[model samples]
Structures are given as C-alpha cells and as structure tokens.
Target chain A: MDIFGVPIQALMGQLMLGIVNGSFYAVLSLGLAIIFGVLKIVNFAHGAFFMLGAFTAFLLGQHLGANYWVALVAAPIAVALFGMLFEWLFLRRLYGLDPIYGLLLTFSLVLVLEGGFRVAFGSSGQPYATPEALRGTINLGFMVLPIYRGFVILAAVLTCLVTWYVIERTSVGARLRAATERAELTQAFGINVPLLVTLTYGVGVGLAAFAGVLAAPIFHVNPSMGSSLVIIIFAVVVIGGLGSIMGAIVTGLGLGVVEGFTRVFYSEFSSTIVFLVMVLVLLIRPAGLFGREES
Target chain B: MHLRSLTLPLSIVAVLALLAIPFFPQWIYLVFVMKTLCFVLFACAFNLLLGHTGILSFGHAAFFGSGAYIAGHLVKNYGVPFELGILAGGLVAALLGAVIGALAIRRSGIYLAMITLAMSQLVYFFYLQAPFTGAEDGLQRVPRGTFLGVIDLRNDTALYYVVLGIVAVGLWVVWRTVNSPFGQVLRAIREHEPRAISLGYPVARYKILVFTLSAGLSGIAGALKAIIFQLAALYDVHWHTSGDVILMTLLGGMNTVFGPAVGAAIVAALNHYLDPFGAWVTVITGVVFMACVLAFRQGVVGELGRLLKLRRPSRPEQTADQPARGESQP
Candidate 1:
C-alpha cells in the first residue's frame, strides 16, 4: 500500500491529476504554437479566448438547457468563429509589423475580454457540475481515479492527435504551412492566403476554447481564471519553442509531471519551478527545446 | 512654433490642478487621484525602458513591490522618516535593477521579457518566503511618518501634497532624461541598436543604465504608494500588477511623457466607478484594451499629441550643426 514513504494510491492519484493538467496544457499550447507559427505573434489573449469558451458553455447550458456534451463541441466552434472575425477585422492589418505590436494588441484584447467578463459575471467563480455519467470513480490496482478526469485526458489526447494530423498530414495542412512560410507565393498561387490566415487564427482560438470547456468542470469558471494560467502556458510555449507543435505537447506533459513532483517534494516552489525551468531552457537552448533556429 | 514653448505653462497648470485637489469635497476622490498619480509615475518610469528603450519588461512589479516592501518595513519596523524611507526604497530597487538589467540585456525582444518575468517571479517567491515581507498577511498598518520631519503625513491633505510633489518631480526627471543626450542615445538604441552600436556607442551599457534608472523611479512611486496606503500586500509584487502598469502605458500612449499618467488616472477612476459593476470590470478592461489595440493604436495621449501637433522636434529640426552620428565613429 505504501511506496517511497508515500501511499501508492496517493501517488498514483496525483499522477493522474498531473496527466489531466498536462492534457489541458498540451491542447492550449498547441493552439498558441499554431498561431505563432504563421503570424509570428504571441497571442496573449489565448487564455481569454479559452475563458470565453468556458463561459460560452456555461451560458449555453444555462439558457438553452444544452447538455455538457453539446457544449463540449459547440463552444470551441463558436469561439473559433469569433476569433476568425477578430483576425479578419483587426489582426489582418498587423501582419507585416513588428511582432511586439501583435503581442501588445493581444495583451489589450485580454484586458478587454477579462474586464468585460468581470463586469458581467462578478469576480466569484461559477461551478459547472460534471454530468451524472462522469460522477463515479474507477478503481485501479493502486489508486482510485475520477471517471470524468480520465474522460478529459482521453478527449484532450484525441483532440491533440486530430489537430496534429490536420496540420501535418492533410493537403489543407500543406497549404497552411506554405502560407506560413511564404504568404506572397501562396497568394500568387491563388490560394487565398488571407482567408487561410483568418482560419488559422480562428482554429488557434477555437483550440483555446476547447481547452476552456474541458477545464470548466475541473477549475471553476471565472473571469480571472485565464490570467493566472496563461502566464504558465506562455512559459510552456517558450520552453517548448514557438511554432513547434510537438514541442508544446512534449513540454506541456513533461512540465506537468515536473510540477506534480515539485508539489510532492517542495510545495512552496510548485508554481515558481516552471519559470525556473523556462530560464534554464532559455540559457541552455535559446531557440527552445524543439524550436528551429531563426535565420 | 510658439506652442512648443507652452510646455512649461502646461506643466504648471497641471501642477496647479494637483495642488488644488484638497479643495474638492470628496476626500476619497483626492485619495483616488493620489493613487493615480503614483501609478502615473510608475508607468512613466516603465515607459523609460519600454517606450523609449524598446524593452518590454514583464517583471517591473519586482522593483515596484520591492520598493513598497522596503518602505513598509522602514515605517513599520525601523520608524524611519517618510522621505528617507522612500529614498531608501528607490535605492534598493535601483540596486536590484542594476543586477537584473545586467543579466537581462543579454537577450532581446521576447527573451528579454521572459527573463524579466522570471526574475520578478524569483523576487515574488523570495518575498513570499522572506520574513520581512510578512508572508501572506503582508506588511500592514504602516505609519505615515512625517515628511522631511516637518509636515505631518498622517493628514490626508499633507499626504496629497507629498504625493503631488513626488509625481511632479518624477515627471520632470523623465522629461529631462528624454531630452538629454543620454536619453537620445537610449532612443537611438531603441530605434536602431546595431546602428547605435556601430557608432562606437556601448549599446548594452546605455540600455542597462536606463533600465536601472527606470526601476529606481518606479520604486519611488511604489514606496510612496505603500506609505499612502499604509500597507504593502502580495498584490503589489504580483505579475498582474506589472500587466496593469503595461495597460496604463499602452492606454495613455507609451511614447509620450504624460500619456501613462493619463492612462493610470483613467484606469484607476474606471476601477472606482466600475466597482459597482462587479466582475464586469475585467471584461470591460479587456474590451477597452482590445479596442485600443485594434482601433486606437496611438493611445489617448498619443492621439491628442498627433491631433494637437505637439510632436517633439525632429533631429533635423534641431540646430543643424550637430550632424547625427553614424555607427562607425570616423
């Protein structure tokens, strides 16, 4: 029953929790990587958009009596549509400028979204209950785990794989890659690069929303939820390297485990350790763990 | 051309407005304005590095919060005079900045931002664990010691004047620095680092120096704020505070001297008025930021400057005798 002076069950449970956290991290960071790959802009509002997705789910479930399953699908799509509008209406104009401006623009968007949400919902977090189907627990050899958490992890992994496949394997993915590398040439080929750009933004934002919906049950839905988590995600993005999807996934999972271990060993440092790793990674491999060197 | 000379008059008018704040019936309003002014100074200091030097620091709250902690400790423990406490707090921040800036200048762009962020996080952790920071409770119930051993700072009127004077002095220093030759070098480095370096200018040194100066000034603002509030909480050192300052800078107009002040004032006032709206304050703030970035890129003061044509004179407009130096010192 005991392992390394800790209960095997407790350790296994914590690991399960860690994996769940990692799943969210992977999904969110993947979205960021996709956007940065093409736009070269660090989307500071990625977390806000994610929060919007959760809130959208909350509202939909409240007003339309939509089930959790319905929200899980619709929230991301809705957020993606909104994101496309933002890209078309605003971010399109900032393509050729310094990436800092893009960062600033997104930072501002965060303020707008977060402030607006706070006004609407108040500061207190609202709970979104897990569906009855997921209310039970599964007993394993060493530990008991929540069925809902397992579902979240499975859903996240499936999402990540589908995103990876779409971006890396499909003809559409080829075009998106082409647009990222050479927009003018892609446009010259009559590929509608502008439209692709907008879609990319939407997809990136949509992914964030999906993560938000997934997270709503675990973490209470709140306006300020995005602010705390986004910074860590940013660090993850940095450690993983911008524009590297695999990097994001690997780093997200790895850091989540590291964070879990830290919590067990040194609780005080659980939060700051991620940033410390980021600093070390930057010094050791400035381009990031998986990023290609900029020419 | 004659309007250029109005800078002095405009500054004086602004000072007068601040001086007359006590005449208002709402004591809370005066305190609010004082808070805004402190933030304005903080934002302006932030701009020295961000707007002029082209380095966006995400960890500026380290200096700001550290300054607050030092001031709080001095008043609560050592019983130091207000002026000395504030001065000591700024000095401490400057010292810390010297070290942080030295390490940070090695990187550029996003990397620099990350490094500052990491450093600030380190400081935040230190404060969280350190005994002097009072842990989670924070250094609370700080005394409003006498200003220069003369004016009683416990009085709201007295505190208001002290804050006003500090803001004025801080603004003046920023203005003077921006116009000075050293400031020009900092700008040059921002606009074109390689070109400035090629001209035999030590670009790194200039950047680090400016960063330290900015940190020190921000510390002063934070210290004054701690004295005014009689408390130094964990929130001061949080990365969110850094983001708030950045918001103030962007909203007001990063490049202009008074823009951050105006932005800070507006945001502080918004917080007061929007308190009734509850959580929507964050949503509104986010919306405003998004709108500003998408539509009002020039920011409030920047737009005003453009509309009024209060632009600073170009290098060419300056006396033609001083040719702009090239990177390579011939």
Candidate 2:
C-alpha cells in the first residue's frame, strides 16, 4: 500500500484525520450556507454557537450525569433554542438594513459568547473523554482506524444527506426556499414566513452545535477554539458560494482533505493554504463554485 | 469665521493637555491609555476601507503586525532611532498594502475579504517561520531609544508626548482625507457604486489607494506600539487583531472620524478593568457588538456627532446640486 516512498499506514492515518476534519468542516459550513441562503446574514456567531454546544455537552455530562448520546442530541437542540431567541430578539430587526449590519451584529455576538465562555471556564482547553461505546480502533487489512473518527465521518455524511434531502426534495423545503426568495408572497400563501425564518436560523445554528458535540472528544473544548476555525469556515463559505448547501458541503470536505495533504507536505503553510485556495477560487469564479449570479 | 480660525489652535491645546497626562500620579494608566489610542488609529484606518470604501478587509493585521515586527527588528538589531523605526514600519506596511490591495481589489465583497484574510494569514505564517521575527518567542527587549534624537522615549513622559503627537497627526490626516473631494468620491462609491462609476471616478483605484494609505497609517500606530511595549509577538499578526480593530471601529462608530478613537479607549479600558474575568472578555466583546449593531448602529462617536449636529457639511448642499463641481466629469 506504499506510494511515492510513503508508507500506506501513514497515508491511511493522514487520510483518516482528513476525513474526520472534513466531517466537522462539512457540517459547520452546511449550517453557514443554510443561514446565509435564508437569512442573508453570514452569521459570524456560528462558531461561538459551536463552542457553546461543546461546552453544553461538557456541562450536561458533568452536572446532569447525562450520557454521551443524550448530550449529543440535546446540546444542539439547546443551541437551537438559543439561536431562536437571538433571531427573535435581535436579528429580525436588522433584516431591512444592509448585510454589513448583520455581519457586524453577529461578529459582536461572537465576541460576547466567546468572552463569556472563557470567563466562566477559564482559558485552557478542557478534555472530554470519548464514550466507552465508541472507544478504541478497528484494524482494517491495510491500516488501523479510530472507531470515533469513522463514526464522525458517517454521522456527518448522514446529516448532510438528510439536510440536503429535506431542503431539496420535500414540500417543507419548497416552502422554506420560497419564503427566502419572496417572503411577502410566501405570506400571501397563508404560510408563516416569520416563523419559518426563525426556524431556519435555529436549524442552521443547531447543525453547528451538533458538529461541536461530535468534535468534543477529538478537539479539546476551549474558549478560543472556535475563533481559529471560524475564519477558515468563512473562506470555505465564500469559495463554495454563500447560501449554496451542496457547495458548502463539497467545498468543506474537499478543502479539509487539501489542508490535510498540505500539512503532510508543507506543515507551515497549512493554515494559509485554505485562504489561498479561496483567493484563487474568487479570481477564477467571482460568484463562487455553486453560487448563483447576483441580480 | 471665529470658530473656523480657532479649530486648529483648540485641537493643539487639546493635544497638549493629553500629552500632560503623565504628569499626574496615574502615569501607569497613561501608558495603557496611549496603547488604546494606538489601536484607535488602527481601527479608524481600517474603517476607511470597511466603512467608507465599503470593502471589508479580513487581513488588515498584516500591515499592523508586520509594521510592529519590522519596528521591533530595527530597534533590536539595527539600533535605529525610534522615529526612524516607526517610519520604516509604515513604509513596509505601505509596500505590503500596495501589493496585496492590488490583487485583492480585483474581487468585490466577500471574495475581497477572504483574499485579504488569506494573504494576511500567509504573512502571519511567514513571520512565524522567519528567523528575524524570532518565530514563537517573537521579537523582545526592543529598545525605546530617543525620540527625534533628543527626548528619551524610554521615559513615560516622553513616550506619552510622542503618542499624543502621533494620535493628533493621524486623526488630522483621517479627518482631512474623509472631507476632501477624494473622500467624497469614496463615500459616493460606498452609498452607490454604479453612480460613482458612471460619474467617471476610477472606483477601484481610489479604493486601493485609500486602503494603502489607511494600512500605512495603521502600521505607524502598530510600530509605535511595539516600541512603547518593547515587544512584538505573534498575537499582533493574528486574525484576532483584525477582529479587534473591527470591533473597535464598529463599537465607536464606523464612518465618524473620532469613533474609532473613542471605541479604542473604551475597549482598551474595559480590557484592563476586566482582566480578572479572563476569557469572558470575548463574551463581553460579543455582547457589546450585538448591542451596538442591534441598537447603537451609529456608534458612540457617530451617534454623538449626530446628536450635536457636528457632521461634516453635506457635499450635495455645498455643491449646489451641480454635477461638474471640482473634478466632476465634464
């Protein structure tokens, strides 16, 4: 299984790492795309929400004695509820203003949430042990793989597929898309557009939280954990073309692998490489890979 | 006419009074205040691009951090005078801004922001790996040296005066730039790009030029800061610095001349006061941002300016609705 003098074992190891990272990237970007498409806001607080989700899981586990599965499901829901509250209380007012206001507001929200978390939990990374059920590794013929990594990859893919199916194929998805495209007309059809908007925001933020829960065992939960990843996700969203779910999912996964490979070859440039790709993508296709042309 | 003639002298007096801060018992507090003032210049410079030019930059810290690094290196290794070190930092940042801005301005909106962010991250990595920057340890123990070869900037009084002088000059330049015909064109572009383009303005070139100027000014602030603090660390170049500047500008009022300064002062003071709260600083910053955007959109200074009716006279009213005023298309 060796190629180019690199061991198959090492290659498989990096590949597994790439896939796991890709899972998080895919899920997070999917949420971003959904929110952007419907709300027309970049939702800069998305990363903060993700951080909160992980922390929620940690808190619930520690205090409520909640098991991993329960925390996994409940954390995102809790985050979604918070997201709904935010939309209702703050974001709904800014829909008429420039998109910059939305970006600014969400940016502020990120600061507050991240700051609050840091103050409460301290600045250091908190460790979350992997659940017993998903512990250990599986020995494939060519290479060994972590069971948790495989689970993350599988779960992330399932989430993406379900989201895509719901948004693209179902009647509810049709209503959602219509509401975004023409809120007034959707209202004329007797559908509650405001509720739909709130629900969409919740669902989008919830996805970010879900990814956070999945990421807890792999990445240490920390106050500043989300800050580093948020910028990269922004690049991903831009390259994929904001508001395009498929584009977000595809670009997120693909860029994660590209980043992983860059780490293998040029360790120093790994962080900047994604941004470089974004620049190149913008140069070649201003509207993004899957973004519709702005009228 | 009386008010017009008194403006410069009044501002000078104000500047001198600010310079007198170190005479007080709270000299240590003056250092902290001066540092915040430096960030005000950074944020205001950034707002020239983001607020007036309507181009959100995600990589502005490249200029700022690079300037700090260059200044730190010059003071530490080359033994250059403090003024020269700051000047060299500004020049380096200007050069970088010209190159990066040229490439980035080819795209619009989100693409532009992403490209700048990437370019800055690239520079951040470069600084991290570059030998002179000291990588992880950063450049430290930088000498403050003498100001203009006479006054010792190492002394708190001298440093406070130097910082005040720099802040006054930077603010004057920003005010002048925003009020000039060139600045009006920029505002036009921000409010309506198509109209500005149709009016025969080279929109992209103007944007890039202003961006370069702003970046260079911000570099001056960052470089001066490194000299004052006697250190240039990796944290200065990180995206968070860029975010901090954005927060400052947004919190203070984006387009107003004094907004970034006021915002910087408040944020810096809060940072110092809230040191006990640790990581919660981010949460507080986020809350402020949310509150500002949700309600205080005009920002602290901008809102104040509006309240006081101190906004610069409207360009349209001054020009008598003529299309051919100044450099207007024939």
Candidate 3:
C-alpha cells in the first residue's frame, strides 16, 4: 500500500495537490500567452493584478458580505476593468519603443501595486475560509480529496479550454490572430485593433483574477503570493514558448506535477525543480518546446 | 565644446571625492561609503551586460548573492583570509555566470532575462535551504580576517579605503571594456545581432565573455559587502536585488560608464535615509522606474551628455562625425 516509502494515500494526496497547483499555473500562463499575443507587452504586473484579484475578493467577502460566487464573477471583472483602463492610459504610449520599455513600465506597476498593498495590509497573510458548499472532503477510493481543490482543477481546465477555443476557432479569435500577425494591415482593413488590444488585455487579466479568486481559499490573501508564483509562471511560459497557448497549458500543468513528485521524493529541491527544468530546457531548445524558430 | 575634453578634470574630481570619504573618519561615512562602493560596483557590473551588450539579465543577483555566500562561508567557516575569500567569491560567481550565460544568451530579450531570473531563483532557493546559509535566519557574525595576510581589514578606515580602491578599479575596468575592441563588438551585438553575426564576429562568444566578466565583478561587490557587514542573507540573492541593480543603472543612465555608479549611490543613499519607511522605498523606486522609462530613457548621465554636447566613447568614426549626428537630434 506504499509507494516510494510513502503511503499510497499520501501519494495520491500529493498528486491531487500537484494537479491543483498545476491548474493555477495553467490558468495564469494561459493568460500570459494571450496577453503577449495581443498586446505584445510582457505584463510584469500580471502578478500584481492576481494579488489585487485575491485582495478584492477578500475585501468583498469581509466587508460587503459578498459570497464566494459573487467574488468569483466580480473579481475578474473588476481587475479586468482596471487592466483595460491601464492599457488604454499607459500601454498605448509604449507602442513603438523597444520592448524593454514596456517591460520596465509593467515591472514598475508591479512594484507600486505590491508595495501599496504591503503598506496597507501588514506582511502577514490573512486567511480566507473555504466556502460552506466546498468545505468537506470526498473519498476517492485510494484517497480523500478536498472539494474546493477539485473544483479549482475543473474550473481551471474549463477556463483554459474555453479560452483556447475562443482564440483558435471563433471569428473574433480570427481577428485577434490576424491582428497579432499584422496589426497595421489589420488596422488598415477597418478592424479596431486598438480597442481589440484593450479588450484582449482585459480578458487576459480577467483570467488571472479568476485564478486569484480560486487561490484565495487555498492560499492566504498575502501581498507576496502572486509575485512568488509569477517567476515560476514565466519559466513555464519560456519552456512552452511565449505566446504558445497549448504550450503554456501543458508546461504549466507538467511543471506543477513535477514539483509535486519532487516533494514526495526529495523535498529540498521542491522550490527549485521548476527553474532547474527551465535551465535544462533552454540549454537543449532555446526556442522552447512549442515556439517557432526565430526568423 | 565636446564633453570628452573634460574627462581628465572630471576624473580628477571624482577620484578626489572618493578619496575624501574615508578621511572624514566618521563611522556613518565609512558604512555609507562601503555600502555605496559595493552597490556601485554591482550596478556597473550589471550595466556592462545590460547597457553595453544589450542582454537584459534578470537573474544577476545569483552572482551577487553567490559571491557573498561563498566569501562569507570561506572566511567564516574555513578560516581563509579575507582577500582570498573575496577572490574566491568572484571566481565562483564567474563560473556560475559562465554556465548561466552560455544557456541564457541563446535567447535574447525577455526570454533571456527570464532564464537568468529563474536560474538565479534556483540558486537563491539553494542558498536558503543549504545549511551554510543558515536558512531563513541567514548567516551572521562572519569574521573579517586580515587582508592579504597583513593589513587589518577589521579597522573601519582600512575596510573603507580597500572597498573604495577595488570599486574604483572595477569602474575603470568597465569604462575601458566599453571603449575597447571587445566592448565595441558587444555594442554591435546589442544594437543589431544579425549584422554582427554576418560580419564574421563570434557574437555568442563575445556575449558570454562579457557576461562572465559582469558576473565576476558583481560577485566581488557582494563579497566585499558581506565581509564589511559580516553577514549574508536571503536578501542578497533575492530577485528584488536583481531589480534593484536594474533600477539603479537605469535611474543613473543606461549605456553610460559612470551612470550606474551615480544611480547606485542615489539608491543606496535612499535606502539608508529611508530605512524607517521600508515599503515606501520600494514604491518610490517603482515610481522612479516608471519616470525613467517614460520620460528619460537616456538616463541622467545620458541626458546630461546630450545637453552638454558630449559624445559617447563609441567607435572612432561616430565620434569624428559627431557634429552631423548632433544636428540630426537637435
């Protein structure tokens, strides 16, 4: 009943944990890929927006008695609106400059957002309880799983799939892809590329906020939470190839599972496993597993 | 009216001001100068890659952090001399940089930056868990052994002067490299990699060499700080330190020799003075980042050079034909 000197039940539990973590990675990285495709700016502040989502959801629950469902739908919209406004106001100016300027701008936004939150809320995390409907554990033959964690996996997968479909199949998705390929040409053809860009950024961040609300129950609402995961997400994006949606989803989930297994085998390397994998991947395939060759 | 003509007097004034830091003899001045010198070296070393080579490495703190950790451990744990430990630190960081730079340089722009970042974070996590680093509590009370087996580095004046001399040498080395044939190639690679490659330049090799040099120098700075403060911790290797160096260099001016130094001094002084308002420091740094990127991408020294009609110490042809170029901008 034991695998690798650990109980099978414990092993399954870790696997479940891995899937849960992977779900968050999948959702976040998917958002990153989309944003990069449409906006062509690395939104370094995506992590901050994630934190904002969690904080906003927590605030609603604490002050307004808004339930988890309301927070779930409202959080993404709220963060999305803010992201759209930010895109329209600031990101519009950075179009022709080198990409580093855009990165620096977003990086600064992350600093301001994180520092502001830290100043208002102390460094210590504030816990959010699991919702009443999802507080209990369900037996899964080999192991027991928390309903909230299971819900996260299902929701994250669903969101990624829907996003992929919308981007890869729908007519609007065609416009998005066409714009990504030839923004000027697309603009010449009478499509509102600029407005599309703003809307795309909103969708990308809405995805992150949705994940953030999901994370609020699992991890405490801490200012540092989003920043910590963001670097790892970047690694996932690189390994999968930037702007590669399928690559992001696969790499994100795969790394999460690898992290879990590392925990079960040698916990010391848990924190470093993702990055180590990234180094190996970059050494072997500089363009990433899914990225096209540099023209 | 070319500012290049004033390099001699500017150098003299700068050296004199640095020399005056330790002569004041106040404990505050020593600590401030010591810390500032290390950061100045750190920022300049980083700028070597970012500004000159056009490789934006986000994981540079790996060298800085590892440099401090190795030097502190050698001196504190193995009873090695301080000078030896510091050299060892630079060597270790250089080795790490070579390995990281090899893989990292294969990808440019954000990918390159992220690779360095992730690798450094791996190193940071390694340090945090490694017993020698003392975990979350951090390694403390490291001994400041004699410098080169003779001079007592424990004295505040000695340590201050030593740091100042090394940092000055480091800055001069950066300035020289930027103007050298090797540095010219780096700038070529930065501005246009494809052209450089087409010109029969071993672009990758030059990039890696510069990357190693920058890493080693950054390590030396970290080692010097560790010995001076007698501590090494999670903060030294954090991603934030990497960002801090970037902020420092950009705030002072990217693509300029003396800019990172000024940037480092300003940032270090801000941290020192605003110690009580810890969170505000980060917020203010963020604001500065936005301002610099938005309005003043040329940086302070770069802007000053433009205003003063100074030519960057670039290739000879550019400097000779500067007047035509100046008219194009104005």
Weakest ten-residue segment in model 3 chain A by summed lDDT: A286-295
Docking class of 2: medium
- Model 2 per-residue lDDT tens digits across residues A56-159: 99999999999889999999999999999999998999997777778777877877787777667778899998999999999997899889999999999999
Model 1 iRMS (Å) reads 2.6
| Superposition error at A153 for model 3 (Å) | 0.6
- Residue B76 error for model 1, in Å? 0.9
Give the interface-residue alpha carbon RMSD of model 3: 1.0
After superposition, candidate 3 runs with Cα above 4 Å error = B25-28, B310-330
Model-by-model lDDT, in order? 0.82, 0.82, 0.86
Best by DockQ: 3
User: Of the candidates numbered 1 and 2, which has the greater TM-score value?
Assistant: 2
Give fnat for candidate 1.
0.57
In the range A1-295, model 1's lDDT, one tens digit per residue, is 7767777777777778788888888998999999988887878889899899999999999999998999999999999999898778777788786677788778767777777777677778999989878989988867888999999999988998898889899999999999889989999999988788888999999999999999999999998888767888887876887767777888888888888777776778887888888778866877778877654
For candidate 3, write residues B1-330 as lDDT tens digits.
Answer: 444556678879988977876766654567878898899999999998988888899988999999999999999999998888999999999999999999898888877877888888888888988889998877799998787777898898888878887887887788788878888788788778899999999998998899999999999999999999999889999999999999898988876777788899999998898889978878888888888888887677667666665445555554533432111111
Q: Is candidate 1 or candidate 3 better by DockQ?
A: 3
Regarding lDDT, does 1 or 3 come out ahead? 3
Give per-residue lDDT, candidate 3, residue B178: 83
TM-score of each: 0.90, 0.92, 0.96
Single out the weakest 10-residue window by summed lDDT for candidate 2 chain B.
Answer: B321-330
